[model samples]
Target: MIPFPESTLLVPRTLFGRGKITALPALGREFGPRGLLVYGASFRRSVAYGRLHDAARGLVEWAEWEHPGGEPTLDQADALRAAAQTARAGWIAAIGGGSVLDLGKTAAGLFHETAPTAAFHAGQTPRHAGIPFLAAPTTAGTGAEATPNAVLTDSNTALKKSIRDDRFMARAVILDGGLLSGSPAHVIAHAGMDAFTQALEAFISVKSNATSDALALTALGLIAAALPPVFAHADAPEADALMAGSHLAGIALAQARLGVIHGLAHPLGAFYHLPHGLVCALCLPAAIALNRTAMGDKYMRLSETVGGDFATVTNTLLATLQIQNPFKGQPLLRKNEILDQTLSSGSTMANPKRITPADVEFLLSRLFV
Candidate 1:
């Protein structure tokens, strides 16, 4: 029998279901009356927002800030911090997609610190504990709510990085599957693919422990079974499975770390302005092929877990979702720059297999149409 590895697992107190959003007001009161609500711009018109607003009425004093689209950036995080400070928020409630959640996490984590968000990105430790944070994720992807890290991009360098701390973990998380009904088909497809990639990579990561492995396997199975149906028809019964799977994948990666797929996805998304999930979808095949030799046993187990050959299953799913490599035939603006950035990523360091420069070149070659 394999021995359990030493690990530190952190997760929020979670309430998951179709109507879990209603519990937010009571959860918010745990921290204090005043809080900041960070959400996606599109969510302003969503029914989910109406439900949340109703729940907050007379229960909590909150200020709303809509996240301008795209990935969270340092400037955006700083702006959010400023808003929370101005509101004298005792907690932060993030309600939307990954970007909105990440912004909320960052703002809350940095609430008491006067240093710029970039300082934390540069490895500066925060001196004060942040306000309580609550997350209600609309999208099943990124698992940002379950994670203790918030990804933010440095606009000047166009490099994506993370502000990670155990304190950044949400105090409470509400995963309401009903919110997913409004997501576009493409959003579901890409986000589901990202969730799958996270599970797969964590399962095969060198750092994976027994806890991570178990969660990754369960997440992979759910994602494999749920993604297609959910993508084909929104509001599928399997939507909850996808949400749970995505959250589990996030938890798995938070402990086990990720691999080459995420390492490459970050640089690609940062430089090309590609959707993160799409980047993962595009890179999955090459990453799997590259890591196959090192992770043969894990791959076989994964294949068994998902009920088919891993490569064939993933390729078919990508095809069914109409997810193609957009980078194909598009010359990388700065090939060497991307290479350096990818190699320097924490995910790359955690990859199960050692990746050399030549291997990176070969992988990039395969991505071309």
Candidate 2:
């Protein structure tokens, strides 16, 4: 495995706990005087919004984006930055799910961009210093707060891209479970699946090392136990269960990268505007199977983590995720067509196994049928 960078920074200063979200008022006070608030439509409705707004009152100038659908594409980033500049907001506080946080993160970076959010992803330099960012996570997935990377969409090119590096990492992160209260069952399932894949992929990726493995293992265990009840009760305070896991997974992937599941899922999300969790759910099983074929005993270790043999546990996971074959309802595709789409993810390269295009076809065929 590739060694984790010894000097890689983890979660910048953080306030992670059950109800500690109340500290948002205090955090807003410190970073305040004037600031930009970026959030998603769904999150804007969540009661936590009122609380955050209340806390930030008078201290910050809020710039609300009710529609932060998944990643913020280059266009979205420009609009956000232009708006922020117009507002003259000093700090940026992003409150919502992975998509919202990602959009805010990218916008904060692209606010000073010369090329585009896509160019930033493709190694562009910043002409202006970035604004300070703060992220408050609503779901227990994607650990975007801990990651320096911000995923964006380039709708023009039909691609989902990433804006990365140390600068984008939040100066402070608040993980309060209260924000998770109204998350729907499907979202719970999707976010949990994302967290699961994050930890698992980081553990098995070529970029993994001892630090990442320890963190991944710690995250995998919490995700196994904490996710189900949270799915059933989106508001349930599986506090200790989730905090450690999500952050651990976040930090793990911060150093190591995620595999094919994420790589493949991005295109589907960019192309179809699908919920990230749903696509991730569908891809997880296939990614795992291919990884198993390539890496060997790692599959056994994964099986043990989930509590069964590779095949049995794998099937159970897919069932739990309610994975839908892309071809299932499409009128244009035959069974082979569905398999072809699902099998074509770029993330396939990150699989532990040396999966070929043909191998993906075989694996996806079994999944759909």
Candidate 3:
């Protein structure tokens, strides 16, 4: 459990608007004329790092993370920490998806510490602070760009964990929907669902308070409206809405925390090699049903958001989307299945209703054809 003191949260100042990333160079210059730029392989990404580099000129020093998958493990954090130490970066500019920005956050958190980022994960040591960072997200996925915590897997133990500290929130965040234009449709579909779930989960989370609820609802409304345009249109207003909604969702989850969707989603990424967002998507519908069962009227509000009948609206929305590799797309959502394994992971530990493993078993068993 996080020891969050009741205090006002300061969402990092965001640079949002049409063509606002152009201001990043000036911000980088203000932070430091010379800082480190941490990233994964930029060869296949939305944001053009070369252009950002050109725009920044001598103000940015570049550091690279070897892992490019959207996930970052503790081992990768160790590697990144080592590189950051050698580079002695004054400020970190994290550009890319969740993994990439997470690496940047971890690097800042682990700056003073050395080796085995797992030690920090194990609670043997905790990160007390972080160097400044600027998040430039290339995808409309994981709001790691705005959050204070970073999740990483321990390759040796196979346990995925996080480095949590509000001190890690970025100094600035840049969102440019144009960057997601060329992203693979499969990737976009999965990540977009992840964003949608974030808003929903946070809205219903027990940790939620007045501040988080407002953000969560606004995010939920935007994400629901944005997904169609973001995915269908790709390069236009829809994309912008998707990314913008994702940013809101990220901030909401940071404050309200996540429900079972994430708890169950982690295991799939660890064991099944399924995409994180795909796992989230599979787990979400059943979680909705289960939570509605537990919270009484909470799901009613969500139902109202989409339409009078939540189940019917949900079915209509899920049916309309087409994706590549239907087999792996919503893996647990096969026709024979009635629910997802994440039912165990979904509302099980949720504050209002702590679902048991037996409940998970029953719900998921119904999912099989």
Q: Which model scores highest in TM-score?
A: 1
> Each model's TM-score, in the order given?
0.97, 0.87, 0.86
Candidate 2 achieves a global lDDT of 0.71
Q: Residue-wise lDDT of candidate 3 within 1-369, one digit each (tens)? A: 334526645555788765666667777667765566666564235356556656766655455545556468876777777777777676777777788888888887767765467777776555456678788777778888878878777776555667777677788888887667667666777787788788888877878777777777777777777776666666767777788888988888877777877876675566556677776776666767777776567677777776557666655555454522322333453212112434433333553557666555544443322
Candidate 1 residues lying further than 4 Å off, grouped into runs, are 1-5
CA lDDT of 225 in candidate 2?
73
Best by lDDT: 1
lDDT, candidate 2, 136-164, per-residue tens: 88777888888888877677765566667
The better-scoring model by TM-score among 1 and 3 is 1
Angstrom error of the Cα, residue 16, model 3: value is 0.6
**lDDT per residue as tens, model 1, 237-280:** 89999999999999989988998888888988998898999989
- The residue pairs found clashing in candidate 3 are 260-346, 336-368, 336-369, 337-367, 338-367, 339-367, 348-355
Q: Per-residue lDDT for 148 in model 3?
A: 81
Q: Give the backbone clash total of model 3.
A: 7
Instruction: State the C-alpha lDDT per candidate.
Output: 0.88, 0.71, 0.69
List residue ranges in candidate 2 displaced over 4 A.
1-4, 57-61, 68-71, 321-326, 329-349, 366-369
